[model samples]
Target: MTSRQPNHKIPETNIKKRIAVITLKSPAHLYHCVPIACELAKNQKFKVDIYTDTEQTAALIKALTEDYNVSCRIQILHPALGNRLLNTLTRHPARAKHIISHNQDKFRHYDCIISPDFYTAPLITTSEKNRPVHVFTFHGAGDRAYGFKQQLCLYDLILVSGPMIKQRLGEEGILDCTHSVETGYPKFDLLHHTAPKKLFSNHRKTVIYAPHFQRKETSWYDWGLEVLEYFYSSRKFNLIFAPHVLLMTKWRRRKSIPKRYYTSPHLHLDFGSSNSIDMTYTQQADIYLGDVSSQVYEFLYHPRPCIFLNTKKVNWRHNPDFTHWQ
Candidate 1:
């Protein structure tokens, strides 16, 4: 009898599936997808990469990783056009084109791509070779018609918060039952576990006046100053005026707060803060006041008293644009 040596080869243990989380537009959008990214990064079988367009988003990603004790690759997508003058002339659509053109090649190498917004649908769907499975997680629960556009059907998988979203998407004939998954809003997962810090020292009820940025749809262009004056003049409640993040991004013409309004101790005006995306205002506020912003849904998580401002006062009862108001 002779002992025979078995032939064996060591298998590679370093292989990990790669995924990409792309965030554009605002920090809120980035925050909406952080929970998913962090969860993916924590898994040993996968490697996660986050691509953001702003410094604030990069900082937020770093903080999230430190807080969660997970590691992932972070990339900031800066405008490829070197000159600011040329960028200003080209405008937003051109900038978006440039970003997609610069990153489309790298994105194709990933096994999967997750996006919180619909803007990236074209990039993922148009790729003819090595197209990764595209997943879309809506950043909000708003009933805007744009949310139900034909582009939504391009995604391989759509993660929705509740049956309401599924129903809406189905009605539009844009979603396939086979591809949709009912996953509760990931952003709220963080909001529910995290403790909200007290923004004001006083015990008085706090009202968060968060208006949208669009001149046509926003309350800011209509009764923004009037609303502020009402809150400033009244001493019954403390006010936190936090408008949409894009309100001051490019549009310089905005309602200037009167000096008298600032004198009031009950009023706290925040144009845009780092904590704006953290739901600090929504959690601390006793009442929710807003135009068409989806932050209203966050406030409604607690089921508090809400006041929707219809600046246009266009019969929203029949308007599909104001379906959220119903």
Candidate 2:
């Protein structure tokens, strides 16, 4: 017993799991993934990183990190091409390729890649070794065919809001029941718990007009101005003219708003305010008005009157594409 001696070395406990949360398009998309990112960042076992394209998105991510007291890195992905002509020729496929090439090494370093987009699916699948798990959280609740596309199968895990998404995936024969989870929309966690702010001080009933950005599907191209003018003139209801965030951002479609609309006290026009993403309008409004925006579902949480604008006047009752209308 006196001659016995033991040597022991402590095991390492400093290794942290790596996760990247990517928001490729807009601030709205970033909002959808913020809860997941924040949760992961809060855990000391994980190292969280966020990749965004725009300054607005970067700023928003920074705010979220500070607010949650979480340490995370935010990287901005700038446009690859400077030439307008070259960019115009290649479109999104070229951009996707550039993003993949730029982040290939970064993707290999992560344990998981979570994105609120479809394009990132291809990027994550490109990794051959130390391949990170790909997770997709769809950004909207709208009945769009693309939402249930076959490309989604590329993801290792799919987080959805409800049975509607699972059913849609099953119908498409792409449902991985083992990997799919109905998390009841992470965005709702913020929307439901946040106190409603008075967007308009007046007591008039408020309506939120949130039209989609698609040219073919949205009422904006056909009757957007008309709807705005109608509400502007109406003294019956206070209108929150908040279009889809992307609608006003497109260079080709950006139109000058009438000065009268801005001066009107009854109207609160927000092109892409932070309030729009936080569901302030949805929470405060008495009525929901929209063309194809999934925000209507958020407003429906309280089950109020909803008026859908069908500028195309398609037989929505019969068309599967217009299922949200039904």
Candidate 3:
């Protein structure tokens, strides 16, 4: 068999007999699918592989490997790239054969390819030989804003967490495929497994502020500072700030984010980095605060008092399908 090339091209073949998953390194997103992937692997139902190109993926793989030995390959597709050109050149159709040559045996084994998000299209396209069932887990809740339609258009099955997503996608006229299914987010299975743990001492309260990073309409960029101040001085409570991990890496380069000081002995801030705490922090927090982040669902698994930040003028409170509290 010939080796894979970055731009290798081949006539599409039928290879969707077994399956594996392509994972985005984001913990929030991966949390929904990893357990399911593990279950699939454990049952020997699918030959699974989780692919990522970020340091966070490495950290997550390390953490998960210790807890679950799910007989599957965890492949690092490539290092972070400044642009898609290099990634395209190295892993796209031209180089696909070269890329899969080492894993040709493994690639040929799976029938379906799954991804936690739409960004993994190139990896799935390259790995599957254009034959496997390409399923994507889309976490976005609304209409196509950032090339979402294009990204989602590629999937054979679009796995979503809620009905709102399915309805929204339909509104956008994305009903061509009969594969959209609501699996209720496999990551929430993790939330279901979490027992109530003490996030702070009995003398201190705990608040969790999880913010989304959508800057075009509403983001926590400016008001985040105000939130830091409000929580820092509240000595009675310990604060946990877990912003959407995407915020940290969105800019072209890593910009120096100003440090906000909290004199209160009870404040803690986390930006979803390798060193950040897991969703268990959500279980321990007494109150939850945020804009529009799915982490809210993670927090509401146990039904805590949640205060939505209306900073961006999102009227989410009255939304009929806000099922987190229900």
Candidate 4:
């Protein structure tokens, strides 16, 4: 009998899916999504690419990829040279918008794009018919209105930490249950791995005053220095005045810290550092103080005392904008 010739077509399951994990926001947002890329890269059936806007972030990604023992190409997000100077001048959210505008064609080629931000899905030419699926891993489990912002409706999948965030997003009419997944804050794993930091040598209780950056909503503009002075003079407690890492990034004006604050052994002033965003201050502080910063929730991992500052005198009672207190 004549031998039947077998078809030479390769199996579809053998094809590796291309996934892009991107973070255009500040370093703080990187913790939310980089580990996810590392985990995804472990699967040989998929190819993962990590994209960032700054060398600072590229270095961070390399360190993390090595720490996690994962393999992935790190791509820097940049506009063309023609607009690179203009792009460098603008700040984030705007800079993020510019990158998306320039990279639409490049992004559309991926099978899946994973980010810890809302910038991607809204700007890219993504439609129901689009090839690449957009997944938004939340940068924070923050309590502020930004957490439940209207822009989140653009993504195909949204990851939430727990029931509180899920319910709040759902009630806002932005989150569809089908698109939302309760991922329970993966950065907690990062925090778990990080050793506790010691800010003061004495046994005095430590207070971390971490305020939000958005000047319109931040208490930093009106009362930040005053709050620092109070802690500086009182020496009763060691103070870590590390505002949200983005605070200085957004504030174009450089407010000089008094020489006294620098000399005070009780005062630990950190404008921006890896310790600021990695829950080092949150984990170590005895008390948490902030206006709208989300590190308060991280501090509550131990259920310590918290004091919220309402410098604007706005009624936050029963207000959805200040829903974390609820």
lDDT of 1 by residue, 95-131 (tens): 5546766667778778778999876766543444456
Which parts of model 1 have CA positions greater than 4 angstroms off? 1-14, 82-85, 88-94, 124-129, 318-320
- Residue 50, candidate 1: alpha-carbon lDDT: 92
Each prediction's TM-score against the native? Answer: 0.88, 0.86, 0.72, 0.89
lDDT of 4: 0.79
- Against the reference, the lDDT scores of all candidates come to 0.77, 0.77, 0.58, 0.79
What stretches of model 3 exceed 4 Å from their correct place? 1-18, 25-27, 79-109, 122-130, 140-150, 192-197, 249-263, 274-277, 314-326
Better of 1 and 4 by TM-score: 4
lDDT of 3 by residue, 1-326 (tens): 12122222223445323566655445555655667677776754345666554556655865665467656667665433433466576643213323333344454445666766654444433443555566677653433244246446656677777777777667655654335788776665554444545544557778887776778434476577778777776656778777777665544312443444433457765666533435677777889987666667667667878886666565555553343323
Worst 10 residues of 3 by lDDT: 1-10
Tell me, by lDDT, which candidate is best. Answer: 4
Q: What is the lDDT of residue 62 in candidate 4?
A: 88
Candidate 1 minimal-lDDT segment of 10 residues: 1-10
Candidate 2: segments with Cα more than 4 A from true spot: 1-14, 79-97, 125-127, 176-178, 192-195, 250-256, 318-320
Model 4 vs truth, CA RMSD: 7.7
Q: Which residue runs of candidate 4 sit more than 4 Å off their true CA positions? A: 1-12, 87-94, 126-130, 176-178, 250-253
